[model samples]
Target chain A: MSDSTHPDGYVLQAYHDGELNDEATARIETHCRDCVRCRNELAELQRLDGLLADIDAPELPRPVWPALNGALRKQHEARLGPAFAFSAAAVCAAGITIGILLGPVGKSDQSSTNGTTWEGPSSMWSGGASASLLEIHLSDMD
Target chain B: MTGMTDDQLMIRGAAGDEAALRTLIERWEKPVFAFLVRMLGSPEEAEDLCQDTFMRLISSSGRYRPEGRFQSWLFRIAGNLARSRLRRRKILRWLPLTSGHHETPAPGLDPLNALAAGQEQERVRAAIRQLPDRQRQALILKRYNELSYQEIAEAMGISVGSVQMLLHRAMSALKRDLSRGRHES
Candidate 1:
C-alpha cells in the first residue's frame, strides 16, 4: 500500500473530484492518459463515487408542516410571545409583593412617628409583655 | 414569494414574516429530510429531527448571521443535530433492556422486491456505518448531499485539506468493504 505506483493518490483523488485547479487538472489529465495503474485507480474511485451518489433518498413523507408549523409557531410565540407575558406577570407579582410589604412599612412609619407605638397586626404579639417590650424598643429607637 | 431566495426568505423570517418562514419550510423540507434520513438511517427519527431543525431555524432567526451561505448554515445545523442524535444512539446502544435499534426500510422500497435491493442498500449503508464518525460524515456530505469539499469542511468544522483526506480514506475503506462483500456474495 505504501509503495503504490503513484506516490500520493492525493492528486488523483483531487482530479477525480474535480477539486484541482485548471493547471493541476491538466497535469493529472496528461498523467492519467499515459499511466495504466493511475487510470485504473481513478476508475475505481469513480466507481465508488458512483455507488455513493446512487444511494437513493427516501421518498419524503407528506408535508409535516401541520405539526411542524404548529411547533414552529409555538416556538416563535414562545420566543416572542412569552417574553411579554413573563414581564407582565413579573411586574404584577412585584406590584403585589411591594404592596404587601409597603403596607406594613406605611403603617409602621405612621405609627412610629407618634413614638412608643406598636402598630402592626395584633396577631404578631402573643402576650402583653411582648407588646410592651416592642413598644419600649420602638420608643428607644424614636 | 416563490421567487425569493433562501437568504431573502431567512432575512424575512428573521424579521417576523410568517409567510417567509412557511415558504422556507416548503422549499427545504424534502431536501433537509432526505439529508437527515440518510445521516441517521431512521426515517421516523429523521422526520422528527427534520421538524426540529426547522423549529431551530425559526427560533434562532433573531440571531441569524447571513455571512455564509444559508444552505451551508442550514446543513451545519442539521449536521450538528444528526451528530447529537448519533451520540445519543451510541449511548442507548449499550443499555440492555432498550430496543434502541430501529432500521426503517429504505424509502420507495417495496418489501417484496426489497429482498434483493434492500440487501445491497443495507450492505452499502453498513459499510458506510462502519466508518469512523468524521470519515462517514465527510463522505456523506460530499457524496450524498453533493456538497463541495469546502462546504463539507464548513459544515463539519474541519479544514478543506482534512475534508479531502477524509473522503479519500473513506472511499478507500468503502472500496475494500464493497469488494469483499462482492466476493462473499
Candidate 2:
C-alpha cells in the first residue's frame, strides 16, 4: 500500500473534475493505477458525480406562465401608477395656477369700461402685474 | 426567437417586448426550476421562487449590465432567493405555529419511483442536503449545472480559489458522510 499523504484525496477531486493540468493528471493516474486507496477515493468521487447527475429535475406547474404574466402586469401597473398620477396632478395644478393667474379669461374684459387695459380686483391677474409681484416676492427672499 | 441569444432576448425584454420575455421564459424556466428544486428541497417554493427570479429580471432589466454571462446572473438571483427563503424557514421553524410545515416531495415525482432509487441515493441526497450552503452550492453548480469553476465563482460571488477549495471540502465531507451512512446501515 502507498502513503495516502503523497497523493491526497483533495487533489483527486480536482483531477476527476478535469481541473488539473496534463502533467498533474498523469502523475495522479500513474499513482492511482498502483495504489488501492487513491483508486477507491477516485471511484467514490465518480460515484458522487454520477448520483448527482441522476437526480432529475421536476416539471414546473402549468400555471407558471399565467402567474408570471399576472405578476409582470402588476409590476408594470405598479411602476406606471405613481407617474401617471403625478402627471395628471401636475396638469391639473398647472391649469389651476394659470386659471388663477388669468382670472376667468374674458369675464374681466367685459367688466372694464375702456377695455384698453385689463384690470382685476388684485391687479395681480394682469400679466405684467403678476410678473412684478413674482419679482417682488423673489427679491424679498433674497 | 429560437435563434436569439439570451442577452439579445434580454435586450428585447428590456425594451418591453412581451414575445421576447415569453421566449426567455421558455428557454430558462426548466434549468432554473431544476436548480431551485434541488437547492430548496421543495418544488412549490422552487416554482414560486423561479417565477420571482424572472419577475426580478424583467423589472431590473434597465439595470442589467452584462457583467458576466446572463446565466450566471440568473443563478445569482435564484441563489440569493433560495438563501433568503431558507433563512426565513429556519426562523419560522422555531415558531410553534409553523413547526409542522416541512418540505414536501416535488410534485409529479412518483412515490414508487422515488423508493425504487434505493437506499444509497437517499443517503447521498441526505448528505448533500447536510452540506454547508457554499459547499452545496459550489458542488451543485459544478456537478449539475455544468458550470465551470470560474462561472461557479461568478454566480456564487466567491473567488475561484475559494470555489476550488469549497468543492474539495464538499466532496470530502460527502465521502465521509457516505462512509458513515454505510457503517450505520
Candidate 3:
C-alpha cells in the first residue's frame, strides 16, 4: 500500500520481521486484513526469504582442529618464547654474580670470623648458610 | 565445556584453556563457514577464511568484552575477513592473467532435486551474488543466518535503520534480478 494511510515497504518489512512494537504490529495486522497490497508485499518478502533458504552451503570437510591447535601453539610460543628466554637468562646472570661475590675469599673470611663453616652457593640457597653469609658479606662491606 | 556459553568459552580461551577454544571452534566452525561461503561464493576460500577467523578469535580473545552477543562479534570478524578477501579479488580481477576468472557455485548440490528447482536455486544464488556487498551481507545475515535486525546492525557496524534500508534495497534488487532472469530464460 503506497497510500498515505497504508504502511510503506520499510514499515511492512519491519512488521513482517516482527520488529514493530505490539501497538504498531496490531495496527499493521488490522491494516493488512483490509489491504491486499500490504498482504502481497509481506508475502513477497517471505517468499524471497524462502528462496534464499533453499540454497544450502555445500558440505565441506570439517576444519582440521589439530592443525589449528598447532598453529595457535606456535603463535603463542612466538609471542612469549623470547621473553621467557630473557627471563631465564636474567636469573642465571643474577645467580652467577652472587656466586662470584661469595667466592672462596669471602667464604674463608666468614669462617675465620664466625666459626661458621663456609659452604658453596648450593648450601647458601638451601638456607643452612645464607644468613651467616649475608652477615659476613654485610660486615665485609662495612 | 560444551555447556558453557560462547562468552564463557571465550573468557576461558583468553585464559589459555585450549579445550575451551576447541569447544568454541567446534560449535561455531560450521555456521561461520557457511556464512563465509555465502559471502565469498567459493567453498575453498570460505574454508580458508573460516580458519583465519577462528585463529583471529583466539589471538584477540583477551580483548573481547562480553558486552554484546558473542555471535555478533564473531560474525563481525568473519564478515570483515570476507569483505577483505572480496576486495582483493576485485583488484586481482583487473590483472590481465586473472581477468577471465569467474566465481563458481559451491558444489555438492543434491541431484534428486528437479532440474527446474535446481535452475531456480541457481538463479537465486546468482541474483544474490549480484547484490552490492552491503546489501548482500545484510540480506544473507538476515535470511540465511537468521540474525535479528539489531544483530545485523552490530555485525555490519551500521545502525539498525541502515540495516533495514539495506535489506529493503536487497530484496527489491533480488526480485528485479530474478524476475529478469525468468523472462530471459
Candidate 4:
C-alpha cells in the first residue's frame, strides 16, 4: 500500500520551491522531524539543487552569432520576395496542370476516334494514342 | 539588463531590428545551449540546434502572443526538439542519476571553500546526462530554469502529476547514485 499520509512526491516538490504556506510547512517539518526516510530524501534534494546551480554555463565561440544572424537574414530575404518564391511557383504550376487535365471534357469531339476530332486542334493526337492501344488489343484477340 | 523584455525584443525583431535579435542571443544563448548540449549529447549538435532555435524565433517573431511567457515558449520549443531527437535515435530509457551535487550551486558558499565542498560537478553532469529523458527534462526545467512544476508539465506536454512523479523518481535515483559515489570515495 502507498504511504497515504505523507506521499513523498508533492511534499518534496513544495518544500524545494518554498511554496508551502506556514501550516503546510509546519506539518511537513513535523513529519520530517520523525520520519527518517522522508527527511533523508528531502535533504538530498536540497543538496542536489545547490550543486546544480554551481555549474558554469557553456560559452560559444565568437563567430557563431554572426552565422546565426546570417541565416536568419537569409530566411527573411526569401520570405520578403513572395513573387519568386517556390511555394508560389508550385501553386501556379498546380493550377495550370489542373486546368489542362480537367478544362475540357465530352462537350466537344476532342477525344473520340470516329468523330471529327476538332479541326485546328486535331483530335488525332489523343485518338492516335488510344487507337494504338486498341490496335494491340485487336491483334491479340485475333 | 543584458537583454530586452521578451515582448519588446520580439516586437523589434519582427520589425527587422538586428540589435534586438542579438540582445536575445546574448541573453538566452548559455542556458539554451546548456539544455540542448546536455539533452542532445553533443556540443556540436547543441550549437546547431541553438542556432536553429533562434532562427525559428526570428522568423516567428509576431507569432508569440503576449499571454505566454517567452522563456516558457522557448523552452517548449527546445523540449519538443530534444524529444524528437531522442525518439529519432531510438533511445533507451536508461536509469537516472541516483545522487550528486545539487542542480544549483549553493548561493552562500564562500568562493574559498569551493575545494572543500567535495563536489565533482562533471560527475553530476554525467549523471544528469544519464537520466531517462523525461526525468532529466523535468529536473533541468525545474532546477536550472527555475520553472514551476506546472510550467514544466506545460513545457514537456506531460500532466503535472506526471511531473511530480518524474521529479520524485529522479530525486530518489540521484540520492542512490550520490550515496554510492560517497561510499566509493
- Identify the candidate with maximal lDDT: 3
Number of the predicted model whose DockQ against the real structure is largest: 3
Looking at model 3, the pairs that clash are none
Model 1 per-residue lDDT tens digits across residues A1-142? 1353453676677788888889878877777788898889998988887776655666567786678765644454344444445554576699678778898766655654465443423211122224433333334334
lDDT of 4 at A85: 48
Per-residue CA lDDT of candidate 2, range B1-185, in tens?
Answer: 97988888888878877778788888889878877776777777888899999888877877888554888888989888988887878833221111112234446768776564545556777787888777877887888788888788889898887888899999889878988987987
Separately for all candidates shown, the number of backbone clashes (residues 3 or more apart, or on different chains) is: 0, 0, 0, 19
Lowest summed lDDT over 10 consecutive residues: which window, candidate 1 chain B? B93-102
Ordering by lDDT: 3, 1, 2, 4
| Candidate 3 local lDDT, B1-185, one digit each (tens) | 89999999888888877778888989988888878887877777887888899888987999999875898999999999999988878833211111112223335645554566767777887788888888988988888788999999999899999998898899999989987988999
Single out the weakest 10-residue window by summed lDDT for candidate 4 chain B: B95-104
Report the lDDT tens digits of candidate 2 across residue range A17-117. 88888999998988878878788888888887887665554566654566887666555445555654555567669957876788868456655646342
Model 2 Cα RMSD, 1 decimal: 12.1
Off by over 4 Å in 2: A1-5, A85-142, B91-118
lDDT at position A23, candidate 3: 94
State model 4's lDDT: 0.67
Q: Which ten residues in a row have the lowest lDDT in candidate 2 chain A?
A: A118-127
User: Residue A28's C-alpha lDDT in candidate 2?
Assistant: 92
**Which of the two candidates, 1 or 3, achieves a greater DockQ against the reference?**
3
Question: What shift in Å separates residue A9 of candidate 4 from its native position after superposition?
Answer: 3.6
